[model samples]
Target: MTDTDIGYRATRRTVLPASLRLRYRLTPWWVKVIVVYLLARLASTVMLVALASVQGANPWTGAHPGYFDYASIWDGRWYDIVAEAGYPKSLPIGADGTVQQNAWAFLPAYPFLARAVMTVTFLPWSPAAVLVSFGFGLGAALVFYRLMALRLPGSTSLFATVIFCAGPTSPLFQLAYAESMYLFFLMLALYLLLKRRYWWMLAPVLVMAFTRPSGLAFALAMGFHVVYRWVVRRRDEFPVRERVASIVVMLVAGVSGIAWPAIAGLVTGVPDAYTATELSWRADYIGHVHLVPFAPWIQAADWWFGLFLQTSPWLGYITLVTVLALFGIWMFAPSVRRLGVDLRFWSVAYALYLLAVFFPQSSTFRLLAPMSPLAGAIAQPKSRTYRVVIVVLCLALQWGWLLVCWGVDGLDWSPP
Candidate 1:
């Protein structure tokens, strides 16, 4: 029998019925992507539980509750406050209603959603945070998987999803922080844009505007994609009318992302209200040295490069080698270079923008997290021994970083 006939016989002889076998045989590619994404997310949840146990805390309680008992949970407290009440304004001024601080300074999307969920379901914000965390993490994985499958085959795409879920940065997904949500929106926007679903892409881009100031990156990347298509395809995929509408949509998303903080600054009569707070914190904790002429660019580069040393010293050393390897790969691998208007350029650009804007916070590395998919797409072994060594070293370094951060307790929930 031919391969097709032999495969059919094997399926019939298997325990699964013919209908079930056919169903599995014909499972849609996207459904398989979702399954892999969910499995990776479930694995991440298990890792979180294990991390919490090692830290002598209950992962189920999460960061907010853990904060009450441990000072390490300070970052979780900010998210809690943002979730429960809107951002806090400064206390009451004189009877004349003078404002002291702008509570509205905090971005509204995450906290607003958190509060809405609590109001509707009577679920505490802590558990709600966890639920949102899980949802966003899974959503991000699914989007990333789809994005990878656009450029990679099934096995490579699945491996990329796993790496994203279990990489050293995975702990961020378990925290009350906004990385999970930010990445989810980002990946969704990218996926929709790749699929040429411009209108659907606009919705997530709009929501992303409220998630973080960095949401603008999504719109900008989409704009780049449009320009790329115009140049290369010459196909009126986005007609003149649609293109005009998309421009308007991008403007709205970009403005809304920075609206709250901008408004807070105006209300408080301090142009640098939020920026000052972040700068002060960075200087005090991270020893950030401001540079002249190109302060933002310098800070951004410092931040990206700093990730190797700041997060985990051991990982830092491993990352040094990994960086070298990456540089070599990028130089030599024509396939990776030709992957085209996908994540590689977008991620590097976003990372640059984040670094320039945020002054090199260690968390900035997470902005490049999407590159993990690209990494998996290009991962191949020229020789058996070489593949085994690289895989073991990379996984070991990633796990070691995860363990150290988890053992220290509450790294994600609180600021460094």
Candidate 2:
């Protein structure tokens, strides 16, 4: 059977009876995405509950955490605080002439959604946040599946979806985090851009800007597109008006990418309000630094060295080797050629952006969740045994990551 046929049969076997399955054989591809989501949810929930069962005081609330409690720990706590109390009017500063960690550090999109959901349904912030994540996570998966189908067959796309869900940081999608919502907007923006719906892409781009600092990746990709059309392709094919319109759209996207931080700075009366709050988390580094270009590499080096030098120096080398390997893949992998120029450019730029701005920590991999679409570009295994082994390894690592990094009582030391 073809890969598409295999996917259809697997979906049919899940819900429809043998007699009725034949009648519904032409089910929409999205139903299969939903099936994949349900399966991933089940696996993640089981693993999360297993860890929560061994919990002490939940760091976020200082209460004995159940499953919901575990989901809202770490950065989720800050999101909850923002949702419940809202950001302060003035920028918070510390005694040493530095910014302090505050709600301004987090983007407001996810918390606003959670608060709106809570108002509509009369649920607490914890469950409401998870519900928002679950719904948006499903939508993101559906859009992601469609995007993958543009380049992959049904079975391979399904495998990519599975890999996205079973990624080590992917469980955050089922929690009270903004990863899912941000991804929903990010992928939608990319998909719209890929379809060449230039003006229509602005809506998601605007929403994405308020979701995370990484929204700039979209603008960067569009800027590359402009350079390709005007310079590389020499602008000979399209009409002048069409070319001008596309350029306008890209310029709008570029500004909207940094609109959130700019607006926040203006409102808070601090020209660098967002940067200050973000840097506050690393105040212990014993140095003054601006959020200028290439700062995160130095910050990541310092953080990782401090973390591993006393514990296990080998871990630092392993981390370096892993990053270099992924960089090599982004640069030269033949499979990446199939992802088209837009996604390929976006993925590499996004990776470099993360390395430059984000400090490496426990939540560092979680920040990379936006690159889940790259799973579609991964070379597939030729043998069933290899495929099975890869899936098993992915799921095992996810569970292991949660238990080791997320479940401990004092994990508040690092962002989740």
Candidate 3:
């Protein structure tokens, strides 16, 4: 080839990437967020549709169910029951006298909204549920960008949203679940808190309380935030009125956090109805046991180690402690600290809350989606190679999650 031909080819190659980057930079911020969202949903749709094509007769649907049918499989049925029949006047009791898996375990917010959509659009539970989830997922993406922009540069904030959209549990975004709804409100609440819009924060806080089991975790974050403001009062100037208002909001949130259990107990004659129903799901792995504060993880570890692996349970205990310690240290990393006090405190509080109450299992990854704010720290590094690698890894894990957790493998124990 002539030297001129070689130079022209090199110039064309250089100009192509630069032109694409320029166009991308020129796009509006909201459009960029929506673009990544569409891309993520497209990729997830392909995987779920492929799974549906091969899905055999399961509890919820038959072989070769469509996309909406597949998305509504696992917890969707429970939501449907809630929407159609409402929570039971009497809890379903098993022969063992423990609460059986019932509609009481699910929060009413997502299903209530789905039923509303059904009323308006005349669609069935499956499609209506998917629509509600998708709408909330879209809202979550938009609010998450605004929240991230509060502390990070615009590009970093957008990348964090991308990471969040493509995360393993992101399938929940399109599925018939409450995770998407809860996440939207959670990000909005956090954004309002950071802006010091205390009164405006109450709206999201109340909605989030009824959406999922996140009220207690959010209260803890707010409580720590109050203390943080007081500690840095000299520099940050936490006024007396602001402190009092903050405390009031925190107390109100804490009460709201525990209100569902009380409501469940009152409606049903069975006191502890909510707690019992929740524990029933875990009973599959560890048999029937009373709920104890800060004991679930240890109990779960012993079950996995001693029963499943036939090994010393002490090693499991040691490993759990070590992992928790490492997680605590990770909170102090420079990148994580850059997320600001509200995000950082929320991370620590939520992690401890999960460590105390959650049993480590397949659902654990889905639960971790609440901590997606930490994705900002991961997005902080400006390495193009690293960003591409992480995006690929996220999608790969998405496939793994669908196959291992969401798919109804024979005697499937993992539920997304």
Candidate 4:
């Protein structure tokens, strides 16, 4: 038989054995889902345990020391306070009964969820919150796997899961932070967008807005996607009514996402509450001190270069080069552009986010974490050498942030 016929026959016969057919029929969908879910969970657990062990064994402790002790280091304490009681009139008093001025410091959704969990389960808020974060992170990884599987082969999807779940930044999942939850919403939004399920995408986009201000960026990015499609596709192919509906959906999604923060600000009468809370602590930080046009340059430097080197100097230098290299590859490689993914849209959104946070007085690393997944998705390399370099750099930057979080003297940029 010719090669084509032989291949075709092989494909048909592969499914023919009665025993093999029975095995396939007997396999439950839930069983497969559970197995993949457990795999991701197991990977996250391992990383968290490793982080906890290192912190527990370390001799020199910083401001807040312990496995997840850093929770109280920056915005973490604020979240805990918010969970115990609603946003206080003013910051809570210390153990010594000293009152502080920053009461509207915490973000709303995470702490609110933590408070609900604490009230319902009667468990300590810290551990309970961390557990919830962990579960959400695992779910996010699974969603990422599902999304990637749509665009890549099964093996690549599995590799992407490993890169996402077990990579250096996995420790974020163990903390009482909102990265995991935000990521869960992000993945859900992306899945809905890919499936063209516009209404489903709106729900998670709304949840994301409450989780963090950057959630609005996702909605805007989706809006951009809709516009790009309309601009590129032939006008005659899409009816005017359908085009109008698409525009309406994008507007509703974008407005709804921003509406949450606007409502929160109005209720609190803190017009710039989000920005104010973020910058309150770092008001004197170099990036925030500059103000206006100059602030963007300083912030970009701090985020793209400063934070890494300042926190972990050696890794910082390596990461700086890696960042440049990845950007270089993306700009110069035609193959990467031709890969059919909207890498440019994500890259632009990320740039806007970086600029938006420059003067916000938050740690560049924490502010930049949400964009890492998008970066990873778009940084796929065409050549073997490019792949190796990109992967190494990504892992280095990710792990470097983990060390910075653990080792820095004043590392306190959790999403309160």
Separately for all candidates shown, the number of backbone clashes (residues 3 or more apart, or on different chains) is: 5, 0, 0, 1
Q: Write the per-residue lDDT of candidate 3 for residues 105-184, one digit (tens) a residue.
A: 89888899999999999999999999888888988999999999999999999989999999988989999989999999
Angstrom error of the Cα, residue 20, model 2: value is: 11
With candidate 3 superimposed using the best TM-score fit, by how many Å does residue 47's alpha carbon deviate from the native? 0.4
Better of 3 and 4 by TM-score: 3
TM-scores of the models, in the order given: 0.71, 0.87, 0.96, 0.70
Highest lDDT among the candidates is held by which one?
A: 3
| lDDT digits (tens) for residues 1-416 of candidate 2 | 89999999898887578657665456777887888788888999999988877777654554446778788877888999999998888987668777778898888999998999999999998899999999999999888887887777777877788787677777877898898998998888778767777777778877877887776666677777777667655544555765776677677777876787787788888988887787777665534567766666655654567554554545555677688697766656667777777787788778777766766666777877877878886625456787778778888988877877787656355556
Clashing pairs in 3: none
Better of 1 and 3 by TM-score: 3
Evaluate residue 364 in candidate 1 and report its C-alpha lDDT on the 0 to 100 scale.
42
User: How far does residue 258 in candidate 2 sit from its true spot (Å)?
Assistant: 2.1
Provide the lDDT at 181 for model 3: 97
lDDT of 1 by residue, 208-252 (tens): 777766655655665666566567655646577667765665676
Q: Which stretches of candidate 1 lie above 4 Å from their native place?
A: 1-46, 54-74, 91-106, 233-238, 285-333, 370-376, 379-398, 406-416
lDDT of 3 at 155: 92
Pick the TM-score winner: 3
Candidate 4: regions farther than 4 A off: 1-73, 89-105, 235-245, 287-294, 299-344, 359-362, 372-399, 407-416
* lDDT winner, 3 or 4: 3
Residue 250, model 2: Cα distance from true site in angstroms: 2.4
For each candidate, the alpha-carbon lDDT, in order, equals 0.59, 0.77, 0.90, 0.59
